[model samples]
Target: MTKHLSTPLANSMGIQDQVSFHRTELAIILSLYGRMVAAGEWRDYGISALKNLAVFSVYRRTAEVPMYRIEKRPKLRLQQGQYSVVGMDGKVLRRGRDLKQVLRVLERKLIRAVD
Candidate 1:
């Protein structure tokens, strides 16, 4: 067998890379995270890169489900945008082409002062 080292060959062999958030994407997300942390709204977070999507989960406390999840799905980029914010109940809070815009849904909740 001969070796075909090319992009087409790799694709033909079904070599798919996992989708992940870029450094800049994470930076923006983290900026909000930092603010939430300081406000005591969020205590922990998790990141997951899967075959079709990347997820950033925010938690108020450990050992429980995430309060919110930010997901990036390139497959939906052309249709309904890529960035999405999901609530803890698994509902889509916001979805948009711009990450910052989708992220604003969460930021709105942070605007109020904690009693």
Candidate 2:
């Protein structure tokens, strides 16, 4: 069996009362990715789980900056809300405590006119 290294948060920060993505985060992010792919709006994506944050970045092309970044920061869980959707310019489209609500910002992009 392999041993896992402990981090500062695990050894010191202890249990945080703040909310996080949990399992549903993956489902929500993946669902959005699928729709964006089908719409031909997104070509690539990346996920990052940092010490204090988690980021889901959507890219139209590999070299260019991500078109959108869905981030989860537990430290800002209460102050700015845990979930946030940011645009390419790093502009926050939405931030809230509810994951579903925070994700709604992206869902709006999926809407199209019946032409």
Candidate 3:
């Protein structure tokens, strides 16, 4: 048996809303992070869960701005897909319904940085 925790949110519609990555999602992201770290392309990362979005920020160093941000916005799912990878310059590198596909953009960057 397993126990799961639930968090209550502040909202007026009498509806509960929680934005966060699932365990499997985190596993996938962490695997990429591990590879980038081993390749010496990434040093630090952060995760944030807001009312409408979940973000994974990657940084070269703790003090620097995130080099990339992977965002998930369920509101955008039907219209334009929920997964997006944004570069430091605030450009959308890729956006799609598949997280692994969107993350491939960063994999290319790792190759470039390593060489």
Best by lDDT: 1
| Per-candidate local distance difference test | 0.94, 0.85, 0.89
lDDT of 2 by residue, 49-82 (tens): 7767888899999998999999999878779898
Pitting candidate 1 against candidate 2, the one with the higher lDDT is 1
For 1-115, candidate 1 gives per-residue lDDT tens digits of: 9895668977889988889999999999999999999988899999999999999999999899999999999999999999999999999999999999999998897887669
Per-residue alpha-carbon lDDT of candidate 3 for residues 1-115, written as tens digits (9 for 90 to 100): 9674543343445666658898988988999999999989999999999889999999999999999999999999899999999999999999999989989988876665335
Q: Rank the candidates by TM-score, best first.
A: 1, 3, 2
Descending-lDDT candidate ranking = 1, 3, 2
Candidate 3 lDDT score at position 67: 93
Q: What TM-score, computed on C-alpha atoms, does each candidate reach?
A: 0.85, 0.79, 0.82
Superposition TM-score, candidate 3 onto the true structure: 0.82
TM-score of 1: 0.85
